[model samples]
Target: MKRFFAKKEITAILFIGILFTLSFFNWRSAYATMKEHTVSYLASAGNKWENLSSFIMDVDNTIHEQVYQKYYYIEGYGYIQELLGKKEINNFEVVKAKDGTLHYTYFTSGPNQVTSLVERMERLKKAATKVGSEVIYVMTPDKYVTGVTEFDKGIPYNYANETADNFLQELEKKEIDTIDFRKLMKEEKEFAPDSFYVSDHHWKVETAFWAFTKFVEVLEDNYGLVFPNKGEYTNLENYNQIVYEDSYIGSMGRKEGKLYSKVEDFTFIYPKFETNFYYYAQNGSRDVKAEGRFEQSLAFTSLLSGKGNIYDATNDKYFTYMNGNPGFVEVNNFNEPDAPKVLFIKDSLMVPVASFFALGCSKVYMIDPRYYSGNIEEVIDEYQFDYIFVSYTPQNLTEEFFPFYKE
Candidate 1:
């Protein structure tokens, strides 16, 4: 008994010593990440002190994320904040909502400058309309839903909702068709809390499915791309809902850590009906071409393998949809060959939700302006689709997304 106790004490001491040494290495990596953040900040939107501060918080989050022992470091930091009742982390770069959701926000001096962005949309409309392709601006819900999500005093408000309102209004004036999903979110008040993940900025997969139904409704009512199985398409009962509880930590959750925010439940939803697709996706550097069923070819099930212990921040389960924002993506729905061909030029919010188009449209093509290497006008001219859609989250309403036909 005496020898066993002696060995146990030695093991504990050595383990503690190793952890102490690891802390130095973590900080060293953190400092290097800070330098990268500095360069990235200078290059983009980090023009003001407010932007700089939030961007630095991003650096802090990324540094710890890259460390050898990042999970423990994040756990410790989260615990400290939990004990101190810190509703705001990183000097309000990330704040906990009254409902416990994490948000990336900062104090807004005024509404964002979207006049030029609207002009860019107008130009794209002219080009698309010239080629006989219609343009529709689809607005995804902002994380900070107005009149629903509340934050503690001294927390920052980014006014992204206001900016979205401004942007959509301008598009309407330009006679560009627009879909405001915020209205739908508000109408369904009971599900507002459940609509978005408390730990991340993106909507839940189930919510994305619901949004897709809405997209089909618009296409049917306005553009005449109606589906006979539209009712079956929106029916959640016909889908396989696999709930991976306590497994997700989203982009925002990574920054704040688990203790500061609860682990999210990823409800992976897909159709129970038969489907076939020929999918081709390219992110400029790499390309994937496959032909199979929905789960086989369209979705990346490899991301879902890590049940409850997903730590690599980049291994985000949310990325399971279309394997993340590929620069260019084509889904030929052999199941719906006679259906309309749709196109989306937008952001990551649509990246997952657009998968539902397989059930409705005959063929779907998506371009994430931030990634696609091909010419937008050339693609538009070459393919005269039934409809063309443009969606950018309010927070992402910047010059980078409106990359087509900008004057």
Candidate 2:
């Protein structure tokens, strides 16, 4: 019995050894094939591995902070494999001409971007003027340009201010009407330390109010439209509530590679007016309820909503603005007939600013070129706007504006 047991043990050991040797050779060849496939797949997918890898790394860090380090590393390896196998491109930054102004040796695409935007403005202006509508370019300030407290000194490039200056000069040369909000803010010293949110890129609602006031002034001066003073407009500060209190990770914070820090809590402010309001985007027209007062929607809620068909009937609500497609958005105000029909060509930075226009304009048609593939000229012709405003952040201005213009 002992001899039989010994023979069985030796046989088992030999079988296990042979299996290990076969697996070793197989793994090497398999690993080589995997490497080749990964490279080929990445090349076919336009080499988006960097962005995919970064996103995976972020997810890993988030999970790592929650649990074990080994889980994070293992998940990261899986993410790498998935990324290499992907057939589609995810996130990408738009490229622009490198020859432009330099701020602290960090050059910006200010010249090309501004020039191209001005040219688009010229086309838009001619189209609007042909329809007997006025064109007003509303240039919004970036957090860095506006000198928001948290971003006062950290920005590597003074590109925001440079872009603003170049844009203004180019517009002036073309005799285009513009609303320079940055200069107005600077002249008024609106950059009170806490005026901007600590973590987010957007200014506090108070800043928007101030901007609205300036916008009102522009309307009065340029179009001879008179808006009532602050006393006449309802202030909803008392009704303002904190809808969400958790720390937010904003675009800038993510781009700056500082995800660990807590972002400021975003507060949603509503006017003391009634909440009975409805809105819809359809057939190139935005229609709203005629009777009820406009209730301001939560800022963050809008961000949570993703993109879809703009003409769908399901989008006929104020909250729909938050999640609707980024292309052309038409919002109608049923309050007054004489209210201006505005064409707001802007970036994501203009989302919060749309609220101010809601109060002023009878209808606001917003178009984001990043998502819109159709001819911008045709959209302008179809909308028949009374006023046109172009607003964007410095980063987008430097990167995206040129491509849209070139197209």
Candidate 3:
């Protein structure tokens, strides 16, 4: 009789606890989504009568998205992964390397098809030639470094390097001048594990600066061009290094959270020398213009201004370069009148790379095809750039990047 009474009492306490927890979540989700839900509900009122089940699902999804403390919930999931000793997170969408770096990857056995992609590049070449500008396919290195990065058993490899090799070979056959940073980085003894962030897919700003130095070398040797301040532009010591520890949670970090992977430190590198720049960017109706000094003009330092422990999704610190790949952005270096005028059709990897132009370029225009609403060919003709660089990482060898040249 005594044991039966104790069991009943324990069951009653657990039941009440579960009910209270459910009620708390229900109230939060309701309060959080009340306005949006009401608007959406009215928008779908007619559809609700026609396809009642479908309308019900829309409500369900809205509720699902509005879970209170969503970030904490994902963090809890990351903690669970740590407790389980799982190297792969969210079913292999992200994998942890031996060094604890997060990588975006999917299962692949061999190289990806790039014949059509090469054709797109060939078209880009034609466009550049039509505008009297020389073009080069600048291949940015993927985050997954060969030999240096390793995954545990059962972790899926993305085979991005092999894909890159095939794509470059195709470009070479077409006589397309190319710069493969993967090969360049491999040859550099200093391009070791430390050159990358531990928890982000993007390379460090220092690495991007190193790339800028090498790119200048290419121009001087191949294009018969000489930089005005060659010594000042290439040297890393001339740049101001601002570092904030425990400051960043990268794209992958936001997915896996701090428990599965540690929060990464962010570093900002800018010219220590006095300089003047005029920058303008446009994305839809959002237009931003900055002038006077590199730090104030080119760099969007507002993203780094954090209000405490909580990270805002809108403020992705990595995009502090040129305000994060707007549809169109132009930079005019008031100091470098004789500097080469260059244009870049590039991805996010080239955002920081374009900023390096502030050191010497007279004019620089960048267009991200994914966002730009203007015609690429028109931009090329009007600008008449001295050099046009079409740069994309190996992983981005897809229909998305080659959207410029379509029948």
lDDT (Cα atoms) of all candidates against the true structure? 0.83, 0.53, 0.83
Candidate 1 worst ten-residue window by lDDT: 306-315
Please give, for residues 6-79, the per-residue lDDT of candidate 3 as tens digits: 99999999999988997788667766566665566667635556765655676777676566677788899999
Encode model 1's per-residue lDDT on 68-87: one tens digit a residue: 66678778888899899988
Cα displacement (Å) at residue 401, model 3: 0.9
TM-score of each model, paired residue for residue? 0.83, 0.61, 0.86
Q: What root-mean-square deviation over C-alphas does model 3 reach?
A: 4.2
Off by over 4 Å in 3: 1-66, 308-311
Off by over 4 Å in 2: 1-113, 145-155, 226-231, 234-246, 254-259, 275-277, 281-321, 402-407
- Candidate 2 global TM-score: 0.61
Please list all clashing residue pairs in model 2, or write none if there are none: 279-316
CA RMSD (A), model 1: 8.3
Candidate 2 structure quality by residue, lDDT tens digits, 158-262: 356676778778888998988877777788987543555443445666676667767776678777764433334434453444444543433322322122223
Ranking by TM-score: 3, 1, 2
- Using TM-score as the yardstick, the better of models 2 and 3 is 3
